[model samples]
Target: MTVLSYADSALSLLPPVVAILLAIFTRRVLLSLGLGILIGALLLNQWSVLDTGVYLGQRVLSLVWDDGAFNAWNLYILGFLVLLGMITALITVSGSARAFANWARQHIRNRRDAKLLTMFLGCAVFIDDYFNSLVVGSIARPLTDRYYISRSKLAYLLDSTAAPVCVISPVSSWGAYIIALIGGILTAHGFTETGHLSAFVQMIPMNFYALFALALLLCVAYMELDIGAMRKHELNARKGNLYDETKGLPPGANADLPEAETGQVHGLFLPIGVLVVATFYFMVSSGADALAAESLPFTIIGAFEKTDVGSSLFFGASIGLVVTLLLAFIQKIEAKMILKALTSGARSMLPAIYILMFAWTIAGIIGSLETGKFMASLASGNIPFALLPAVLFILAGLTAFSTGTSWGTFGIMLPIAADMAMGSHSSMMLPMLAAVLSGAVFGDHCSPISDTTILSSTGAGCHHIDHVLTQLPYAVLVAVISLGGYIVLGFTESVWLGLASSCVLFLLGLVWLKWQQPKNTNA
Candidate 1:
């Protein structure tokens, strides 16, 4: 196998660093990412203006055509997204979603229930983060709006539950990706005896950030706790203002869909139920086939290990779209109206699809520059064994923050972290692995340019920057708690102790925030 090489100089960091800074300063994600790709191409081509321009164009074209639009994994994601959009459109056009919201109005009764329902839906759709964000947002938005919950709060709830839940769920797209990365690394390092699925299971307990985020989300929902910018948004929401007048609402808030005439809940439940059931069925069937192809016995975990997640998701989404259309027809929705809804729905996804493509392109550019390698190389020496996990966590977090991608961070850091652990304290392997995963998620959760973050904002009909600002404090709080846990685990090597301490710390933090709420309100 041939590995792409770079000069291993500090310049290797320029592309991502510049991209992150530009995004923060300008708040223009597409421009920032495009600039980052251009810079990487120029660096790779040694700054020849003509060659750099040519290389940049070729790279973009190749990424869109060869690696993204046509690639099997990319195609699956595109198909899934399009089909999901169609399903959402059908639901909206048929008035199923609005009807469900009407039904929920009678049952929800309070702000806490609305928020909790959003969180529950987010957690329930754990198969894919993209699916989770969009589906939960569409279903929960109307209910949240009825309760006067801030769009920022809705976005935060959707965002928090998305990647965090997927990272921990063993049957998710995230799990499949992590398994493949770990499996390849273990095989390369002659540690194949410890199966990838088993190793991933071991890391779950140590995934402090994901666990803490979920716990904190539930606490926030149940307590109706509002702090920082989120507090202001919540206060405004109570006055019938869903968003800040200055920031304005997302364009998605103005989608052109028909109103609910029937106000029946079955329109919502039956289609979503089909989507959930069909997704799992396809995942299991695809995984089973893969396992059989390898002449291996079919077990649930083993099947997931072999599953093609993107393809399964695509198939599942397709089935969901079909089922939703059938339901729409039964509801007396005309064929012409259904066609219009499908077109409108797919069209609505264009912004998110473009963002996803740019994110992928930037990641590819950074990968070619070997940026992760340069960052990981710093961990090889000078860092003490006892502090390695904590240090690695910080490094991984910074790298993911700069790149705005958790999966890309995993691709870069997992192999390096695994190798380092194999050569040192074998017992530290789980903590280190968990550190990388947690750190990546923490960064991705916070980054304004992250795809999931964008999707979350879009789903909740919140301003993208508003979502980032309102959610940052909570993400940082969890990250701090997770970092402390990793440091303790590094020293004590006790997963239970580390987890216990982290939970206590998180609870204390919440209490302190609550105590300071009066001052915050006064301010």
Candidate 2:
């Protein structure tokens, strides 16, 4: 079969299924991505005989490299990780994290406040979800543990909010790429009128996935609707069957907690502050381009037309790291110890980074195979057009869940869905698109093997499996509500109706969960 035809056979379902299967069997999402990508590339290459793998690799690499924006995001993520690693090192070696923990331990009397603080700090680092995860996870790991909040749950919050929040915020790294993608797509399809600003602005409200994901995260965090696998896994997913993995309360877990240095919390705030100032400055200055808003006068930045969030963040984090290292040097902190903490943190990120490279390669394969078009073709135009919005949302949701990327889901869905919307339900186009985006995010927000989920797990010091297990139910809860809202929006043509339906669904789910629990159980 032709690549596109086979793509018609399997694209959305295959990628995610492959990812899930790999992660479950091998405990490695990257390897699965590699395999999936290889299959995609091979399909794209028409399964050429005699040295097909070699031919496929060359073609796929060439195609991916042909587009600069596509390639930059991967490197951008990698470079961004450096700052996160350094900041982690800086915080640890400088004893700032230790001091903060001590301060919080003594001052904070309320557990709810502490949980909210974790979520608040997570919101504070809105520039990049990846950045948010690494920084927040490392910082809040201890704080969450102290309050008896499970690491799995903490990771869930961090991961859930990271990508969804970044995508929603214009200043975040994610927003930049999606904007660029949208601009290109709109311009290519003659959809852009007068420089694409209006089109982009219109897309924001339609981004249902981002909005609902944020709502879902808030629901999980403060509302504490820890039902389903959340309550079950939180109770069980501990290491070695002897420890609580979600809460990190297993024996010997805290044995590694630093003596006095772990108790230090000075200079930790500096890195965080720099991140905020730099992010705000860049976001405001760039106006709309992800990189255009930064105000970097030094380090070869003055020569550039635009300053990327990745570059700005990396720079700010570097300064924070240097300041931290200096603090460590000025004090009697052991250099070996400092280096070890950094090395450990860096080591911890390897799996995530590896998975990303593979994810990119796999996503590339799917793109090369024209998977989006194939999936687009699969839509049954004969079906009631009213169902399109809801179906699109569901498709987008599944795509995001499968690929673990909302943007990928959007990229594949938006054009065709938009075309369908424009042709059949002209007025509902904007809301329809929003539903697609919303569905994409809903899937990504909850998926166990998604990069964001992985980072959240890493951030919260929650075992990867634990986070996935705990977070899945919340994602489903929100999704079910969102689906009902999409149905209302499609049929009623009223945005308010869809929104109201989703709210009702959410409240109903929460109430049902509460009612289903055993009476007089421990809070």
Candidate 3:
């Protein structure tokens, strides 16, 4: 099926809007995405039933295979998710999670301590958002639960930290991908004064939303400033109801699994340690291999740029899974019990896998509709130079929120944003680019179909929509604060002044929330 002429028009916006609104109101994520895909297909096919069906089937098939080859990246990622599920289950069955919780109980005396520790763990695991989202929640849940922190709150912590932290850290997979993109953009723009790495470093302070998001997370943790729906969830958690039982179990929560009585903290630590180390090793090795094949210099950043993230993650999870199984055997867990845990863990991941599949499908459909290009086109007209950063921020946020993929938005908007800035506001290039990064992360944080958001909910064992709803207000507040910062930077052309403005607004937000809401008893 071919895209209709109307594909580039306002009609293209209908599908995602329908999906997002439905998801928010009905809380049926898969259904919403499916309907959106169908609408997108119908639009592309001019409402022909047969063509729509054919196009939809072809799009779904393209997810796993296209161009006479298997989509190894997608398959590898799906495999990694299953393997990680098994690893999580194996560790829980080994009683390591419990042992670690028991050990933590001695050191963490209050709810604030548990929350702060969780945030710290999230920040520490900044290599990849996917790994960060899943690993942090699995490790931090038991401790947070001990302090009566809601699964929703746990999810908020994971979702907020994962992407925000990764986008800012220069050593992360996200950083590598972004740097590679920026390198090309810089070359295309004939920018000669700075290298890719240097440009990225320069933009760090200008990425107001990401920095403020992390800062907001810190305040929420230490000061107990749970705003809006989050406050409700925290209250429910304090009352010993971590989540609404009537809403059904989340993706990673297998309620029927039994735990071993004799397990140690080493059981939990070893598998996670191997997983992290192996992933890092494979990433570097894979990147190096790719670089050597291309006869490129073997720099760390170059290697990361060439790394196969999906394959590396899959291999790392496999190694970690093997170690987990061996640990179980050494602990003398029966073969039948081990087998049960394996099946249960894999089974627990099915819901998340299903959601991810639908998300990927609809994202592809949206791409075909050229929704992002259409959105980017809006900013092409003559506009004042001083407002460029703020405009790019809003446009980037809209594109990502519609498409549910920050990387896709980056690909579409970065070039346009860079070109716009370089053409007139050359000095504002870094600020505009930073605005795009900040806005994309904010949109990714808010989108119901975003993979990071889904993984965060899965990791924390909270209902996905609950995580979406609870995190929305917090994300919006930061976006608002960042928008103001971009505006200030656009006018003043001073990164520090812009950053100072955001910091002030953020602190003022915290103080206002503190004064307006009653403090939690635990706080």
Candidate 4:
């Protein structure tokens, strides 16, 4: 592990700020990230322009070889992506995806039902964001397309549900990771008896952003609430175009692949079913192995705490791929054709893989510069305890947004938030903890470089920047409401009051947007 020095200087904040601004302005994510990395290198090398170039070159090479490529986590994610891509390709080639879409279309009457089903599926696959995004998008894309839903809207639904649902679900990979983090922080701070799980449960109601995001999803889907760039995309979809023409087809367009002579819904359902079952099996078994020495009554949550999520996902995906290939052969797909489909599917995922690698590299560079610590330092000084929750919420969001990694932000903020609550406002610990988690998700949702954001676009087959642009307005609205909720909670310390107030605010905001829709349409 690389030990980062905590520097309380404004320079530490430059990389991510530069990266975000450039991405928004230029709409070139790769170039923006590269420039951010270059700036970080220059700062680290004491502003020597010549050395900065050499340092950036060497760092990029090392990252590709040593860090990004060779890291076990990265390799696991790559394997999962490749296998998932292959599975998706095989399904499409076998016409299984089309078959499933046709079957679904028979049951789904119109756009509203299609959107509802998509949301339901997204919410159902809450084990991991990666799995949720890929699976939901793959299965629902055809249905949404058949109903004239924009790819941007589909991407928004996928992206919104994945992280938000996982963060709130108790028996998920996210919950396990968060509980472990909480446990460690409590232990370190001499609060071992606090019951991390209990605290987590208590914090759920105060997870305003997750709640609001999910609520807004339903409002957007059922109410057909379209605003900003999303409205334009929706209007275009209604006109028979699924995406912005200027933005072009998403990477890994399957236009060239020939559909099978016969499409079978079972071909799609069976493989996905096997994948889901296998994932849970692997999660439980791996988790159990890690908790073998524990006392009697081994709980599911306990197993989850010890689960190696990356390995389990890779294991399940590999199994799912094998099963899919066998099914293809059983359906009399030629060996040569199967190979082609698999290769094509895996090839399609390369763009997303590239984005993930660069995102990881930039995250690492920003971490080395101690950007989190610099942000944390800003929380110093005597402030009213009633205002701390809102303050921490904003600070956590800023950190996660800049780094484009919620897990990283959690590590930086959780400990500090815990310490603050313990020292000053002991009674408000759960709310503060919830604020941190909520803020982290809020920031991650809005960040273009976030892994979930990238996967959402990939899964929905939408241009990445378009997904980012269309989703930003919704994310910002929820975040604004969440901040207000935290402030209310900070003062009243009433979870019910805070939650109710946020919900009301969200509804009012929706009404305002709906009222403005006519003006937007006219203009």
Cα lDDT for residue 342, model 2?
A: 66
Taking the tens digit of each residue's C-alpha lDDT, what string does model 3 give over 1-523?
Answer: 5657444598888888999999999999999988998998899899999999888888889989989999998899889889988988888888888888899899898889998999999999988899899988888988888888999999999988899999988788899899999989888888867899999888899999899999989988888887788888888888898988888778887677778999999999899899999999999999999999999999888887889889999999999999999999999998888998899998888889999999999888888888998989989988788888899999999989999999999999999998888788687888898999988999999999899999999999899899999999999989999998988998999999889999889888887878867754447
Point out the worst 10-residue segment of candidate 2 by lDDT.
246-255
**Model 1, 414-472: lDDT tens per residue?**
87888788888876776888899999999899877687888898788787777888999
Give the candidate number with the greatest TM-score. 3
The TM-score, computed over Cα atoms with residue i paired to residue i, of candidate 4 is 0.94
Q: Over the stretch 211-274, how does candidate 2's per-residue lDDT look in tens digits?
A: 6667766655655556765766444433223225333432112224243353356566666666
What is the lDDT for 523 in model 2? 32
- After superposition on all C-alphas, the RMSD of every candidate to the true structure, in Å, is 3.3, 5.3, 1.3, 2.8
Candidate that scores best on lDDT: 3
Candidate 2 stretches with Cα past 4 Å from truth are: 1-5, 11-15, 25-73, 176-209, 236-264, 279-307, 518-523
lDDT of 4 by residue, 147-202 (tens): 88999999999999999999988788899889988878777777767798887887
**Candidate 1: regions farther than 4 A off:** 1-7, 67-69, 180-198, 241-256, 334-336, 519-523
